[model samples]
Structure formats: C-alpha cells, structure tokens
Target: MKKIWQLGFLLTMAFVLLVGCNQSETQKLSTGKSEKTTQTTDKTATYPMTVKDALGNEVEFKEEPKKIVSLIPSNTEILFALGLDDKIVGVSDNDDYPKAATKKEKVGDMEFNVEKVLSLKPDVVFAHESSAKMVESGLQQLKDAGITVFVVKNAASFEETYDTIKQLGQITNQPQKADQIVAGMKVKVKEVQDKVANVKQRTAFVETSGEPEIYTAGKGTFMQEIFDLANIKNVVDDQSGWFKIDPEQIVKRNPDTIIVMEDEKYFPNIVEKVKQRQGFDSITAVKNNAVVKVDQNLTARTGPRLAEGLEEVAKAVYPEAFK
Candidate 1:
C-alpha cells in the first residue's frame, strides 16, 4: 500500500537520525536542572520514554537526551512541546509544526535514507508501533552496532495519549516538567468537554481524502473518537479507516454538522465547496452555519497537543455546548 510505504519512509527517516547520537556518555546533572526544553513561554515539559524497541533490546538515556530524533510526526510535535526542540537533531521529512520545524533536516519519507540518519548521531530515537516491524528490521543491525532506542506505544484514545505524554516525561528525566504540561493539557481538555458535554447530538462528516473518491475515519479512528468524545454522532460511523466516498452518499446522509479536516492550506473554504456540491444544498450542514474547517495536523495526528485538537473538533461539532 502507498500508505505503508509512506509510513515506512516517515518512521525510519525519523528513527535513524535520533538513534545516531554518539554513545559517549554525558554527565547527569543533579536532580533540579532542566533538560533541553522549548523556550516559548515558561511552559516546562519533560517525560520518560524508555521501552524496548521492536528489536527486543532495552534502551535508556540517563540525562535528558541532548540530541534527539523523532520518527513520527505526532511524536515530533510532542518533543517540541516538551521544550525539547533543541535536543531534536533531525525529524521525519513530514514533521512540520511551530513553523520553525521546517528549518530542521528531514531524513526522508517513510523509507527514509538510513545512511543519512546514521550521520546525525542522535542521542535517542523515538518510534512507535505502526512502524515497529520495519523499525525492527532496519535497526537490529544498528543495535548490534550499539545505539540506544525506545518504542512508544502509539495510543488510540485521548486518555492513553495523556499517559504516553507522561511516560515521555519520565523517560526524558523531566517528570515534574512533563507532569506540568499534562496538567495544563488536562485543564484545557476538561474545559472543552465541559463546554460541549450538554450539547445536542450533531451529525458530522469528517473528510479524509479523495481520488478514486476516497473518504474514511469512522468508528475507530481518532477523528470519529473525538466526535464521540464531544458527544457528536458520526454519519459514517460504520465505515472503517479512510475509504472511497462520493458526494451522492454524503448528500443522502445529509449530516446536520460537517467537519472538514483538509482544505487549501487549512482554509474554511472547503466547507462552502462541499455545500455547493449537487444535492448537498438540502443538507442541514450546508443550510445552517454548521460547516466547520479543521486543520489536518491538529486533528488527524495523535500527539501531545491532541487535547488542543480535540477542543477544536468539539467546538466545531457543538458550539452551543461551549457557549
């Protein structure tokens, strides 16, 4: 599958660079010193992220990994958020956020250039389950060569995501900092939930992509899950993953609320375009001001800022609940 290759390219490119960090041990500063963290605002974030990689070897970095590499886009975002941006030496070719991320080097897409990753010499590499097999195949040799690696469970739910974030804090030796970040996120999540918990059920459609007319993200995806969290009913809850779709089906569905994750550069215009489609004129979302635009990066990727993304989804799906 194209996505599998894409997944491979993104993950490997992300993994190689971070794990390439020099094995030369760095002295651990006594208990209160902060590791490399992002300087934006005073928001401190840290986390533990050690666990066996798919290769069956234990990996750990004692003093906050000074040179880090993030294979997953979501993990890349989390690293940045945890005030660990400076430590990140390389990122997946797809990791884009905080605008500044674009300035960093990209190893390659899914089937990232392993050679390039080896050169960066990262202190640690962050990876997850989706690419575990590929990561294992590629890194087993690298492990024999002696590189510390860790595998993070790519969590499905928001709660699991929180736990993962906390885990990241602990592994990175910034438990207190990481806890503070999660605490702040919890406040925002609860705020969003409280705002929409009592709203009426809104039928929403989350657009995935289109070519042979593909559309997906139903009952199991993080997108649909977010809707359920907001108490909104997904019109395509029966579908699984992202699938091929047509406007005719959408028009017939006539969902009450519509959520579009992709547009021309995250613009709100797609909502209007979907509304203009044939038959959709009769749909409630098009008739009312129920059409909402969501940024793909914010909603689609499972990461630390996911709570913020959920808040956006919740607000779009249920405005009255928030107000």
Candidate 2:
C-alpha cells in the first residue's frame, strides 16, 4: 500500500514539471519573434548620402542633423524653404526670410566674427564656397573640434540655382518637397517661353549694376535666361557675360529696346534722364521710348520668387506680345 501511494505522488510531480516546461518554451518562441521584427526594422533605416557643389567639392552627408547654422542670406531663405527653420540654431545678421528668421539669434555679420559662430555649437554650418578663403579656415577650426561645416557653391545661372535647391533638399531629407517647388518654377518659365515662341524677336541691351558706362546683364545670368525666353537679342556681345558699353556701342548695336536696372532712390525719373543723355536720340530704344525699369533685387537674386522675376523680365521685354 505504501509503495503504490509513493508511485502515485511521483507521477503527479512529473505532470506538473512537464506543464511548466511547455509554458517556458512557448514564451521563448514569442520573445524570439519580437527580436526578429525589431532587427528587420533597424536594417532598413539606411540614410547615408553624398552630394557635389559648384566648386567641384564632393560632399558626403551621413546623418540627419538636429541643429543647423547658415552663414549666407540666400542660404537662410533656402533653409527655411526646406522646413529647417525650427532646427536652425543661428543665422547671419542679414537673414530676413520667413519673417521668423529675422528674430533668431544672429551668430555674426555674413563674413564677420568667427568666434561668435563657434560659440553657437552648431552641429552643421553652411557657408559659400566663393567666400571659403575668407571663412573656411575658421570653419575648419570648429570642425577639428568636432563640428561639421558645409560649403555650397554660389550659383550664377538658373540651372545651377535649380540644382542647388534640389541638392539642399536631399541634405535636409526633403527631396520630394524640393522637386515639387522646382517643378512649379520650371512650368512657369516654360509658359513664358511658349508664349513668346512665335513673337517677332527684337534686339536689346540689359544694363546691370548702375554705372557711368552701362554694364549690361548678359548670358550666364538670371536676366539673360529671362531674355532668351522673351526671344530678345542681347545686342552687347554676351561673350564676357557683362561689360561696359558707351552710347556709341549702344547705337552701333542698334538695339530696338533698352532696359535699365532701376533703383527707386537713384533713377526715380528714368524716362527723362535717359532722354537727356548725349547722342541718345539716334538709338532706337531712346527714339521709340522703349526704355523700361526693372528692380535690381528681382533681376539678381536666386530665390523662390525667381519665377515672378522672370515674369517681370518677359513682360518688360515684350509687353504687347506677352499680352
């Protein structure tokens, strides 16, 4: 009787042990599955990037930055457009975009006070390659102390401007958004071109940077790109992009129209002033009263509003045809 009872107890204990073991195995399988899912998610989060600048500098961008500092006025505008204004830690004194940029703490004047920039402790600093010699060394010193400084090429033409915006969008992890903005601009520019496609082309001169001898806007400039779409001949050889031309050069080219880079403060009454210049009556632009005024800001800068700038140029060049 005693042996039978002992055997029965042993059997009951064996059953309990088996039940616990099964529960433990089930939990182990569930935990393993959770780990596998986590690893798969992490594996696909690849975001290393590379880019090139106008100065032929190959830039390798590897991480998403939380804090950025811009050293140029144009860069400030671009940064805000890329949805980085909130992350921007510092800006140049002249940054006036999004209106909020005006209130941010300024590191320093565009090319002044390197120490102020270092004090901001920016994760990344954006500068112009053209001014690299003036500021790149200071930036490198900050880089050596574990900072990242990036230089963007200054774009002189419309295509380069588009490329710069596209590249910046990638850096900010907003490539799709950047392309959308650029695509809209291309559409607007094309509309103007298609309108003037059949218009009678005209010869012209575009003066840039007010001067004693007119320094005209020519090829490789935003003004020239607009002029091309307007189907106007830039009388001064666009060979050197821009050069000084006297009244004789103007009459010799015999441009049908002349457009001055106007400053409201300086050339308030351009029509009367242009009429009084010596030997000006012989020129077609002066004779037909085809002289027009254009804002210096719209004609020069590369910004989101450039499409509107192109519109102003196209209309000024061929008012009747565009209408």
Candidate 3:
C-alpha cells in the first residue's frame, strides 16, 4: 500500500508539471500577439480626429480617406511619397511628377475645377494655403457640397515642409509612411550639410527666370533656405522675397556662381542664355563658366525631392567637395 501511494503521488506531480509547461507556452504566444497588436495600433492614426489646418480651420476626419484630391503640385508630391497614389483620384494640372500623377484626373491649375473635383467624389480635398484666397469661393462651394477640405500650409522652409508631410500622413492613415519620409529627408539633408561643412563659402545668384525681367530669390524664400543649407551666400540676401531685379545689379554683385532654375523644356540652353546676357559677359560667373542650371521642380516644389535639390545646389556650388 505504501509503494502504491508513493507511485500515485509521483504520477500526480508529473501531471501538474506537464500542465504548467503547457500554460507557460500558451502565455508566451498570447504575449507575443499582444505586442504585435500594440505595435500596429501605434503606427495607425485614430479616426474622428479633428485637427486645425494651415488656415486655422478645424477639419474633422471621421474615417480613413479612401479617395483624395490634391489641388497643388507640392501636395500631390507629398501624397505620392506616402504611397497614397491609389487613393489620389484627382491631382492639379501642375502635378507632373512621379510620372503616375499625369495619368490621374486633372483638376484646374491655379484655379481648381470645383465641378471636376466633385465628380471624382473624393473623401478629402487637399488645398494649399498659397492659393486659399484665390480659391476661397470655390473652396466654399466644395464645403457647401458637404465635402471635407483641408488647406495645407505653404511650406516655405524644410521644417514646415516636414510638418506638411506629417499632417497629410495623419489624415490618410499613413502616419508611419510620413514619419519615414520625413526621417529620410532629414538624413539626406544632414549628409549634404556635412559634406559641404568644410568647403569655402561662395557667393551665388539664383535666377528663377531670365531675359525680359530677371526674377531672383531673396530673403524669406525657399531658395534662400536652400542657399543657407548649401553654404552659399545669396548676393541678393538683403532683398525680401522674389522680385524683378535690374540686370545691372547682378553685374554689380558679380556673383561667383549663377544658379539658373529654368526648365530645359521651356528654356533650352538657359545657362548659355545667362552667359550671353548684355553686361553679364563681364560677370565673374560667366568668366569662369560657373553658371549651372538646376531642375526647377526639384528646388521649387517643397516636397520629398527638396533634399535632392539641396544636394544638387550644394554640388553645383562646391563640386570639389562632393568629389
């Protein structure tokens, strides 16, 4: 009887140990699943979110936007970068990047088509602060039609541009993608800055247009910020904003470099054109053939490519440093 009781006790103890092992394994799997769920939740934006737009108007989002319309090229570029191309049912006429945007429905250029946008039946419309006043009545028309319109800020600097991207990401349920885009931009910007950190600072003139009236970027403009990042001094830094400057003033400044932001498609041989300008022949940039033509879209559009623009400007200004 003693031997039988001892054996029974041993059997009971073994059964209890086996049950405990099974429970331990089950708990581990449960914990892993819980962790994965939390991670996913953290990456997604919650709906019924009300956020203030650049115009200070409170825009409420009830659910993830399935259909989107971008009224500006910069906004369209941001949307495409966030992998929301499928959701973009309409884009402004000016949106020509990503090659895919051109295939989307065309809204009017500076003057967006309210009827066309309505026809698309977008869940959200991304307008720009720059054209808000110009399209006020039209935007109100869309609002009256019970459509959600969010006026994105005109991003004048890199930081503002990053914020614009993040805001778009939040509304589209692409917060993770936005963060990733911004982080990548920041890294590329830093890399360019570090590359030119030790280079000699050169004076440059950024010409937005050439011929009839010369338009150059000055203080408080996006190109000014690009100049600052690339370690190049803007000869017209004293002037505020973009305006027509006398060609003689450029002669007086005699910048070490002349960076032209004209599209080759519209203005072929733009660099040569700059060199051929009257009295510009004596300029230092023309003498040294330092006139460089950069992609206007890359530098002008405050989008993901702005970092690439910075690198181009930096390399143009200091080619030796990059080499």
Candidate 4:
C-alpha cells in the first residue's frame, strides 16, 4: 500500500512540472506577438497610400519610395535632413547644400529635365509650389509617364515649414525623424526668442539686392516674419512683398541696423558698398557701423536651416542680448 501511494505522488509531481513548462512557452510566444504588433503600430504610414499635393492632385504610392528626385534645393535639403540621402537619385542643379547633394545627377535648374528624371526611374519626384505653374507641362509629362510627382507648398512661415516636414515624413515613412527635426527647430527658435525677450526692439532694413536694382523684403514676406520673431522691427513693414526700394527711401527710414543677404561672390564688399552709398553715411546704421552680412541661402531658403537663419539674424541685430 505504501509503495502504491509513493508512485501516485511521483506521477502528480511530473504532471505539474509538464503543465508549468507549457505555460512558460505559451507566454513567450504571446509576448513576441505583442512586440510585433507594437512595431507595426509605430509606423507612420502604410503601403498603398495616397496624398494630395499643393496643386490639389492626388498621388498614390504603392510602397515606400526607394528612389527619389528633388527638383528644388529646399526639398533636397529637407529630404537629406530626413535621412533620405541614400534614396535620392537626382537633384536640381541649384542644390548645393549637404555637400553630397552637389554630386547627384543634375536635372536642370529652374527648368528640370524630364528625360533625365525619367532615366533615373525614380519612385517619386518632389516639386515646389512656387514653380508649379512654370513647370506645369513638365509635371504633367511626368504624371502621364505614370511617375509619382508631389508638389510641396511654398512654406512662408515656421509653422508652414513644420507642416511640410511632417507631410514629407509621412510620405516617406520617416515621420518620427521629421517630428524630431521639427522639435529641435522649435527649441532653437524659442531659445532665440527668449534671449531677445528682454532686449529693446530696434528697427532694421533687409536688403536682398543692391546697385542696378535694389530690393528689400517687406510685409507679407518670410523675412518680415523672421524680423517679428527676432523682436526687431522691419522699416519697410508698410510695403508688401519683395519690392524695389530707392536708396533715398532707405535714408528716410533711418533704420537702426541693416542686414544684407547678397553673396560676396556676386556682390563683393556689399557692406561697405551700402555704407558708401550717397547720403548713407548720415544714416544711423552706417554711422554706427551696424551693417551686417548674412548668408542668402540661410535667410532665403525654406528648409531645415531656416531656424539657423533666424538665430543668425537675431544675433547680428542684437549682439548684446545674446551676450
């Protein structure tokens, strides 16, 4: 009777161990499935997606693009910032940033080469809203060839720029990277704003060109928005858009500082040229030696470096505040 009882006890112990081993294996499989589900949910976009462009045309992507062509420098810069450099097969002739972009196959400047772009067999091509009308025929040709073309909006404000980045991120399946870039931009902008918050506001005049035809950024322009954010007043705020301003008119405005965006390669000694202009010596900026030169690309291009442009402008205008 005692031997039979011991045998029964051993059998029960073996059965309990076997049940515990099966439960452990089942839990492991369940955890792995849950992890895969989370990964799928984290993706910003899925395959066979459709998106609307600035021209109100819908373009569909069967899958994430493996090859891309950017027709504008700004779009190329944004793409590079999103870690899509490896995917870029062609770029505009004017794309000079990121160093590597300069080595890409050129598809022409303002007028892109449809044949060249077609030869690349890109999965998608990025166009800009500013040149949409000018390149309407080329874009249509691309569409007729069954190539996907997305017209990015001409971003005029930081918020609009952020939207562009986010849209591209979703389109390229780099939504997380796009969000991180935008967050960093916002932080930099806020830091500059906070730095100048206690500083006294000063009036400024921004010159985009000089000599034969002088031009300045006025109201309804991106530079005006930058000026506002930097806590600096635009002397030409009364005017709208980029318009020619007489040297005499600048004299009359008597701005506290002057910012020039002309490249030295095209306009050498531009700062001194501004100071030596007839009757400019009497201006406050010229007298105080406050004429500053900033990179045209940084100030003009609507890309990832726009916040850097703002910081450069703010620092140039208010050096004391930054110190």
Candidate 5:
C-alpha cells in the first residue's frame, strides 16, 4: 500500500512541475537588460532583477518587492528574520512565529484565499511547491492577474533549505542578512555536532503525526538528516520520504527511543496508545518508556530556525549530551 502511494506521488510530481511550467510561460515577462551574475558580490541587489525560483521558473522583479505576501509560515519566518517585517503586507494563517506576523492580514490557511491575496495587492507572493497541486487554479488566477508568485520547492535536505533562504534574500534585497542567518545556523549546528560526536548512536522511531495514518520520516527527508546530525539512526531510513509504518514492523525493529513530533499535549496518552497497540508492547522503547516530545514546527519547517530544530533533536535523542 505504501509503495502504491509513493508511486502515485511520483506521478503527481510530474504534473505539479507542469503547472509551474505553464505559469512560467504566462508570467515570464522581460526582467529588463540582463546584467552580469553578481550574486556573489557584496552590493545592494539591483532591479529589474530576474532569478530562477525553486520551481525552475524564471521570475522577474522590476524592483525590490516591497509589498510582499507569504503564503507559508516557513517563508514568513525567513522574511521576518531578514528584517522585512515592514514590507510583509500579508501572511498565511499559520504564520505565528514572530508574533508580529500574527498582526498581519491573514490571507487564508494552507490553501490560500486567492481573493484575499489579490486584495492585499502584494508586489510578490511567496508560495509553497505543494500549491502547484493543491491550489493550481488559484495560482493560475494569480499569475493571470499579472501578480508575481514564486512557489518555493520542498527542500529534502538542510543544504537545499539554506540555498532557498539565500534565494529569498537575493530576491528580497537582503542578501547580506541571508548570509549572516545561514552562518549563524551553521555555527549552532556545528555546536550540536561537536557535542554528540562521542555518544553511542541510538536507533529511533520518529512519529510525525498521530496513528491511523501512522506516518514517519524516511530517507531523503529533512527529519532523517536531523536525526543523523543528532547521532541517531532512524528505523525507517530504508524508505524514502514520509511513509506509513505497520505496528508489527515497528515492533520488529524495536527502536531504542521514540520521538514524537506532535504537540506535547498528545504525549503520555499517545505513549499509552503506542504501548497498547498489539505487537508494539514488546518494543524496547515502549517497555523502557523512552518516548520524548519535540516541537512540530522545529522539525517540520525548513527555515532560519531549522538550526534550533536540529539542536532540539540532538537533545531529545541524547539527553546526556546536553548535560
């Protein structure tokens, strides 16, 4: 069943790319005279700027996009970290990190309200790659209305995430700030890496959501990379991306620790559920009660705060390292 779903998702990915292609064709207006590639130079970004976005689409900005709308929390966090708070005209309903973001006009939930986004009259809108599949028509409508929208790709690793952050900084005229943020992240991650180097690696079972669906992060996902940094081995590392796991399989693997990435409120009770599940009772993590809680946003969102997430994972997986 998981294989079938994975295959379907791969096929769907092709269609999603095509959606971006179609939008690119419609929205790829001339960015004005092409200038030399000075992305490496330390200077204020010049406009009529043109850059290729995560979706492999060439997006042009006549000038620095001031009235910006971010349709995702990750992008919103990056923008705020770059000190573009005054320029952020609107944000998604899920944008809650900066607290100031909460004061911004709410466009909509994950599936953004096209009407609300347009009413905000943003010069540029930051979108997620999933929007290609989830709100293709709304995205098309936004493109047709002459609005510039850049759909950020789903970063599978931390390196890719850093590149996206740099890309955002370039387009938003904050390249220097982006570099500083990435540097800080690297320093923090290095601190955790150095501390966990001597610890014995533990096999971990990481749960992304509550049961019934029973999803866990697999190979090629950000979670797996974070686990690796923490000197923890994922039980489901053999699979790719998020995949469903059967209780029997989990018991067979018998992970040494279970890390729950949901709200803390779900703990103890969810821990009980894991213990009650047939075949899961005999699992080492269940018998030893080694379940730990991690914030969902830290592990999930691939933004500036990802370094903090990596540190949290290291602590959760190996509490002794922190002490």
Candidate 6:
C-alpha cells in the first residue's frame, strides 16, 4: 500500500511540471506577437492629410510622399533646407542654388513639361501660383493621372514666408525642422532690428530693373518688407505692388539710398548707370555714393535666405551700426 501511494504522488508531480512548461512557451509566443504589432503601428503613417494651398485649392495626400518635384526655385530651396534633397526627383530650370538642384532632371520652366514630370514618377509636384496659371491644362492632366500638385502662393510678407515653410514641413513629415528654420530666421531678423533700433529711418529706393523702363518695388512687396525691417522707408511706398516708375518720378522721390538688383547680363555697371541717369545726379544716394548692389536671388527668392537679404540691406543702409 505505501509503494502504490508514492508512485501516484510522483506521477501527479510530473503532470504539473509538463503543464507549466507548455504555459511558458505559449506566453513567449504571445509576447512576440504583441511586440510585432507595436512595431507595425509605429511604421504606419496617419494618412489622408488635407491642406489648402496658396491658390485656395484643397490638396490631399493619401500617404507620406517619397518622391517630389519642385516647379520653382523658392520651393526647391525650402525642400533642400528641410533635408529632402534625396526625395526631390526634379526641379525647375531656375533652381540653381544649393548647386545639387542644377543637376536634377529639369522639368521645363514657366510651362512645365507634363511628360517629363510624369516620366520621373514623382508622388507630388510643387508649382508656383504664376506657373500653375501658365499651365493649368497641364496641371489638370497631371491631376487626372493621379498625381498631386500643390501651388505655392507668392509670399509677400515674412509671415506668409513662414507659413509656406511650415506647410512644406508638414507635407514632408519634417515640421520640427521647419519650425527650427523659422526660429533661426526670426532670431536673425531680430538681431538686425536690435542693431537698427535707435537709428533714424531713412528713405530708400529698390531698383528692380533699369534702362528704358525702371521697375521698382512698391507696397506689399518683399523688398518693401525688408526695407521696413531694416529701419528704412520705401521711397515708393505710396504706390501698390510692383510698378514701373518714371525716371522723373524717381528723381522727384530723391531717395537717400539706392539698392540695385545686380544682373550682369542685363544691367552691368548698374551703379554707374544710376549715377548717369539724367536728373538722378541730384539724388541723395548718388551724391553719397550709396548705390549698393545686392544679389538678385537673395532679395527676390522668398525662402530660407530672406533673412540674409534683410541683414545685407541693414548693413548697406546703416554701415555705422556694424562699426
């Protein structure tokens, strides 16, 4: 009787051990499945993001874009700044900065070649407001081909410029970087502002184009905003937007400083040209030899480098501040 009782006890103990081992294996498999689920959730993007571009059109992206094409130089600069260079498959002919852009496949300027853009298989294409207008039909066709096209409006103010940068960052999953860029720009602009705080605001003229017809920046233009930030009053602030100013009108304004956009091919020796303008000799800028030549791209392109233009203008307008 004692031997039979011991055998029963040993068998019961073996059964309990076997059950515990099976449960352990099942728990290990469950844990592995849970970890794999979490990883998959992390990799998937929350999609179907909808945004209204500068043209007031609602644009939607089904998923995060992996390939892109920039139709304007400003957009290209913004993309490059956001560290999306590898994603940019094509750029406009005018995209010369960041040097790397020049080597990308060129989709025709102004009027984009839909065929070339399609051949690159870009998930999204950025177009300027003017360029979109120029190729509305082509854009519609691209949209019909299931391609997403976003038209960036011309940013006339610093706030608008920041909005564009942030919007692009959101589209590309780099909003943090976008914010950093804008913050850096703000800091630089504030530094310039601080340097010119007590300085008296002077009247200045921005010569956009010269010769038979003189194009100047007026109110609601980036140049005017830069002028305002630099503690200078735009001599043509009375007019609205970009307009041609008669030589006689410029002479009448008689600005204290003249900033000419340098385009050697079109307006070489622009400073000398301004000095020789019939009746411009009496102007304060010419008399003081304050005809400063600035890079056209820096002043004109509404991208990450705008603050640099602002700083250049401040230094040009007030040399004593730096001294």
lDDT of 4 by residue, 138-219 (tens): 9999999999999987775777777778778778989898888888999999999999998889999988777776878777
> What are the per-residue Cα lDDT tens digits for candidate 2 across 1-323?
32232222222322322222111000001121232211111112224544444345544456766788888766777778777878898887756666989987897763546687778777778886545666666777877877777777565555656666666666676667677777888898888888778878888787653446466644544456567766878875445445556767776787788887655455567656776777788888888888878764564546565776777777776788666
- Give the Cα lDDT of each candidate: 0.64, 0.63, 0.79, 0.79, 0.76, 0.75
Residue 226, candidate 5: Cα error in Å is: 1.2
Please write out the lDDT profile of model 6 over residues 92-203, one tens digit for every residue.
Answer: 8768989899999999866778899999999999987644666799999899999999887666567767777877777777878888898999999999999999998888
Ranking by TM-score: 4, 5, 3, 6, 1, 2
Candidate 4 vs candidate 6: which has greater TM-score? 4
- Residue-by-residue lDDT tens digits, candidate 3, 1-323: 33232223222322322222111000000121232211211366766666677778867777889999999888999999999989999998778899999999998877789999999999999997767887899999999998999998766578767777877877788879988998999999999999999887999998766667677877767777788988999999997767678999999999999998765665689898889988999998899989998887787677999999999999888988889
Report the poorest 10 consecutive residues by lDDT, candidate 6.
Answer: 21-30
In order, what is each prediction's RMSD in angstroms? Answer: 8.2, 24.9, 21.9, 22.3, 5.5, 24.1
Q: Estimate each model's TM-score.
A: 0.78, 0.74, 0.85, 0.86, 0.86, 0.83
Off by over 4 Å in 5: 1-32, 38-42, 263-268
Residue pairs clashing in model 4 are none
Model 4 segments beyond 4 Å from truth? 1-43
Tell me the tens digit of each residue's lDDT in model 5 across 1-323. Answer: 33333333333333433322111111122345545554422346777877666677878888888899998788899999999999999998778898999999999875689999999999999887755567778888999999998888765556766777777887888989988998999999999999999998889988865666676777666677788888899998887766678767888889999887644444446766767888777888878778777776775677999999999888877888899
| Candidate 1, 21-77: lDDT as tens digits | 212111122223453433222233233323343344445455567787777787777
Query: How many clashes in each structure?
Result: 34, 0, 0, 0, 0, 0
TM-score of 2: 0.74
- Cα-lDDT of candidate 5: 0.76
